[model samples]
Target chain A: MDTLNYLLQGFGVAFTPLNLALAFAGAFIGTIVGLLPGLGPINGVAILMPIAFAMGLPPESALILLAAVYMGCEYGGRISSILINVPGDAGAIMTAIDGYPMARKGLAGVALSISAWSSFVGGVVATIGLVLFAPLLANWALAFGPAEYFALMVFAIACLGGMVSDRPVKTLLAVLIGLSLACVGVDSNSGVYRFTFNDVHLADGVQFIVVVIGFFSISEILLMLEESSIGQSIIKTTGRKLFNRQEMKETNPSTLASSIGGFFIGVLPGAGATISSAIAYMVTKRVYDKDGSFGKGDIRGVSAPEAANNASATGSFVPMLCLGVPGSGTTTVMMGALALYNITPGPMLFQNQPEIVWGLIASLFVGNVVLLVLNIPLVGFFAKMLTVPNATLVPGIAAASAVGVYSVHATTFDLVLSVAFGVLGYLLRKLQFPMSSLILGFALGDMIEQNLRRALSLSNGEVGILWHSPVSLTLWIGAVAMLVGPPLLRRLRRGRAALAVG
Target chain B: MRAERVFGLVWLAVSAAMAWVALDLKAPISYEPVGPRAVPLLYAGLMAACALTLVLRPHAVAFHWPHGKVVHHIVVSAGLLLGYAFAFEWLGFPLATALLALLLGRVFGGSWRTCASGGVAMGIVLYLFFDRLLDVVLPLGLLQPLFGG
Candidate 1:
């Protein structure tokens, strides 16, 4: 009953005319940005965030708009994937496998509409899960002391190192680089500068927006320029835009199962939409692909990954809102935005700022519905956005990024820093370093250090306190398991395959 | 692969430098048991270890290096971006942005006509959007005399 009342109050906040309009605008802009090749949700949110701040939006409203954009991109990512066989973002990679084939088979409209519907279903279901599970998790987290928090953060980093990339060492290196970057300012506890190098601008630490925009958006522009041409032949949308009844019925089960699976996977720290979609597609293939048409324009293949990715996108919000730990790079950026507002998203958030938390949750419901209604009729138009010349798009994005960063701090120093990071980001991408882990490390570094210090202080400098509590011990064990489990499982699978071949 | 090894060596040197500096940090009357330097030192050590691993066991991976006309395009685009960053305040938002866009458009294969017109139009529209609608104070530079920013 209490939860119901809170949700009702949340609806009251979300339904305000201004909030509704902002949500619509965010979703609309997010869709267009997501439809653009190489501009994923991370870039979409990063570029708009400074604008949101400049507009002086209240923290809750700003979050609602950004979250709507996050959700909108999930729907929009399928546009290029289905039409041109190019994934608009990393999360849409699996969609292109079957979605492109369907387009080639002249079922482009069907593929797109079904994926949109599946995405809607996934988003709605995951939002329900978030509402039901986030409070419980937040309540549990209230029991955590600094030791437990330190352990938990360790587990989160370990998960990223173990799962985010094929090379754990490389991922760990990226995380360390991020931590080093995080250390480049006055120490909050001691007020002593660590790595300022006698620069006044470096005293406040590298701004998150600068790092995010530089690493993702600016470098993306450079990468786009490296390509000779952006032209791709988009397949014509010949078939019905809406899925027929039989087709819908055939994909309903896969969609539901993938949504559930993806949501759970997303709830796990460091597991993101790409992995969720991949796992969901594999599970659907093994269970339901009896005709062996899994890759050649199968409607189920199109729906499965779409549903899972969207669900996982929503699911990634759980740890971020409840535990103050972001599950993905995009969510980390969102959390960084929240930090700028001095609103720490954790157990106390529910008590201190219920409106921000609940309003964001309520708006997700509204955002998904708005996206579905907006996407079905407008997807073709969005697909046409692919024709927007890269020349105009690239320079426009560059200008927006530069101006956005400058607008916030009104400093030329930050502009130079952004370009520097852009160069670093380009190199990192070329070297196959997992940039997400680095960003996550940067986001979590201060918290981990604070918790470690507090826990040590409590224990009079005894390191054993980190492992003393049950929660801490469990988290430490989980970290070890995350590190050791993947390789063991892979070896076992490889051995089994070798035996079968022999 | 050789690039990875070189990057690892450079990273190791950076970590060593970080550790050296961390060793010099002094915290007077610390509130916590661990001082400010401990966390950074720990990160530096861990990073150094990771860098050593990469240096020792470098994997063979191919990098996508641009060639021919692509190299020229990338260089020109990068140069334009850097120039825009330095000249932003001096050239002002409108003029600098327009020039940057025009050059970038040409690098991306847009014809001169479209590049010039589109760049100017986009610069004016964005200026109005940011300056008027969003209430952001953009540096007008040379345009300040006429526009009264």
Candidate 2:
């Protein structure tokens, strides 16, 4: 009864004229951005975030809008995958396997429709998971102490190391770089300025928004510029409809199974949408065994990955809201946004800011609906957005970015900082380092520092205090698991190699 | 391999520098045993170790540079950003933003005609959005005489 009442309040808040309009606009723009090649959810969310923040919407409303955009992108990305055989995001790669084949068979419209519907079903189901699980997890986290939070942060950073394709050493080094960048301002606790170099702007620390825009947005722009003419040109449509009822029925079981799998995977600390989608594709192939038609214009194959991808996207938010740990790059960016609002997203959030928490949760339900509605009817229109030349797109993106940053401080210093980050972002991307981990580290740095300090203060400097409580002990174990698990897995790989060589 | 080594060496040097700096700091508090400096130093040491591994591995990983035109695009984009910074400070937000948008849009591929028209429209919408809707204070710059911002 209490939950229902709160949810009702949440809907009341979400239904306001301003919030509704923002949700619609966010969904619309998100679809267009998602349909564009090379700018996946991480870049798309980061690019639009500055503008949303500049609009100065309250945190809940901002979250609502951003969440809507994210959900919308998950839906819109499939259009390109099916039509052009180009996965708009990495998670969509599996979608491309059968999607393009279906398109080639002139069932593009049917494939797209089923993809959108499955996505909607996955989203709705995941939102149901969010409603039921987030609060319970948040309540459990309420028992955590400062030492536990410190341990959790350690676990999060370690998970980041374990998850990326690069060596754990490199990922940790990248995280340290992000942390060091975070420390380049006034010390929040001691108030002794650290690494500001006498620059007024550094006193506030590097804005994560600026870093996000620079690394993800600017770097992407640079990379896209390089590929200016390499990729396929805008695909011409043959006015073909999508999958039929029989095709949808064939895909139904795989879609349902994958969504369930995706949600479970997404709830884990390090496993997110990309892995879920990959696993879904494998599972669909293994279970259905359609004589290798799986990857070749099989509607079931396309549906499985698309459903799982979007479901995992929704599921990844669970840990962030409940445990203050992000499961993937996109949610890591969302964490950055929450930090900007001075809102910490762990157990205390549920206690201290129930309205914000529930409001965000409620808005997501609305956002997903808005996304499906916006995406389904406007799929062709968004596909047309792909036809816009990069020449026009790049500059307009830059302008919006410039205007957004200026709106924040009205200072040229911020703009300069943004551009510098852009260059840094470009370099990082070129090296194939995970950009999202840097954002995560930067976002979590202050909280981790504060918690570490608090834990030490209470324990009178005894390092043992970190392991004193059960919660802290468990979290420490988890952190150890995160750090040690990957190397162990790597050792297995090496063992296999040695056995083969022998 | 070259890129990884470059990044690794830089990381190592930076971590070493951070360690040195951490040593110079006052501990979290005088009585605090573990000390504020310990974790940071630990992190720095860990970073240095990782950096050393990168440098030691020393593989010439595939280095793919963007084409020359793309390089030009990146450089020009960066330059445009720098220009926007200075221009906004001197000319004010609305005027600077409009002019920057106009120039960048044109360079990116917009027609001169569309650039001029779209620039004004975008400028006005931004003004109303920020100034009127959000009550954010934007620089009027010389536009103080015309729009009286």
Candidate 3:
């Protein structure tokens, strides 16, 4: 009953004319950005953030708008994947596997519609999960001491190590690099400068928005330039733009299962939409498709990953809002945005700022509906966005990124820094290093250090106190298990595959 | 594979330098047992370990490098970007942005006419959008004298 009242009040807040308009505009822009190849939600949100701030939007309004964009990107990613076999974002990689095949089989409309509907289902289900589980998680987190927080952070990093990339060591390297970057500027506790290197700009620390825009938007521009495709060929829509009743019926079960799985996976720290969708697709293929038609244009193949990825996208928000820990690179950027508003997301957020929290949740419901409506009747319009030449798009993105970062402080230093990070990001991508872990580590580094110091101070420097409490112990054990589990699971799966093949 | 080794060595040197610098951190009052240096030092050590692993058992994958004209394109694009950054404040948002876009358009295979018009149009539109609508004060530079206060 209490939750119901809060939700109703949230609806009242979200339904206001200004907020509704912002949500619609955010969804529209997010969808367009997401439709562009090599530009995803992270780029969209990061590039737009300074503009949002410069416009003097209320923190809640800005968050609502950005969240809408985040959700819209999930819906928009599948268009390029299905139409041209080119994933618009990382999460849509699996979508292209089956979605493009389906498009080739002349079921482009069926693939697009089914994936859109599946994405809607996943997003809605995850939002419901967010409302129910976030509060409960926040309540539980209230009892966490510094030791527990430190342990939990360690666990989160371990989970990231286990899940984010094919090689855990590479992920760890990325995390360490991020932590090193985070060490720059003046240390708050002791007021000591660490790695400023006598530069005035270094005194304020690297701005999260600059780093995000540099790493995502700038690097993406460079990569697009490297490809240098003047025009991309896209598959034409031969069939109906809407899925048939039979196709809908066929995909329902897979969609539901993927939604559930994806949401759970999303809620876990370090696990994101990419992994969730991959796992959900694999599970769906194993259970539902006995004919082995999954990669060969099976509708369920399109449905499963689409649902899971969207669910996971929503699910990633759980940790960010509830525990103040971001689960992915994108959510980390969002958390950075919240920090700009002087709001730290965690247990106290629920008690203190119900309007912001509940309003965001309510806006998700509205945003997803807007995305579904916008995607179905107008997917063709979005597909046409593919025809946009790389020359104009790449330079345009670079100019926007430059201008956006410059607008923040009007500093030439930040522009230089952004370009530097852009080169670093390009090299990292070339080396197959997972960028998310670096961003996550950077976002969480201060908290982890703070918690570690507090815990040690309280325990009189006894390291054992870190593992003394039951909560801390549980988290430590979870971290250890996460470190050991992935390789074992991989071996087991590989052995099973070998047996099946034999 | 050789690229991985080079990357590993570079990271190793970076971590070592980080740890060395961390040793110089001076905290006046010790309110906590672990000071700011501990975390960075720890990260540096872990990163060293990872880099060592990469050096020892680097993944066997080919690193693709751009060739000939593609390399030229990448270098030119990067140069254009850097030039844009250097010229951003001095040339103002509109002119610098327009020039960069024009060059990039030509590099991206656009006809000279299309590139010229597109660059100027996009620059003006973006300037109007950011400066007028969003209230962001983009640097007008040389254009300021022409527009007048």
User: Best by TM-score, which number?
Assistant: 1
For residues A426-499, write the lDDT of model 2, one tens digit per residue.
88777776776777777777777878888989988777988889878887788788878878988999999999
CA lDDT scores, all candidates in order:
0.89, 0.77, 0.87
- Summarize candidate 3's per-residue lDDT along A191-262 as a digit string, tens digits: 999899999898978888778877787777667766745556799998787898998999998899899899
Better of 1 and 3 by lDDT: 1
lDDT of 1 by residue, A340-397 (tens): 7888988989878898889999999999999999999988788778898987888899
To one decimal, what is the Cα RMSD in angstroms of model 3 from the true structure?
1.7
Supply candidate 1's per-residue lDDT for A11: 90
lDDT (10s digit) by residue, model 2, range B1-149? 88888888887888888888877766345654544566578778888888898899965555577677667767886787778777776887777777766776665666888777777776677777766776655677878888782
- In order, the candidates keep a fraction of the true contacts of 0.80, 0.46, 0.77
Error of 2 at A20 (Å): 2.3
Model 1 stretches with alpha carbons more than 4 Å out: none
Chain B only: TM-score of model 3: 0.93
Please state the CAPRI-style docking class of candidate 2.
Answer: acceptable
* Candidate 1 lDDT score at position A416: 82
Scored against the native two-chain complex, candidate 3 gets a DockQ of 0.75
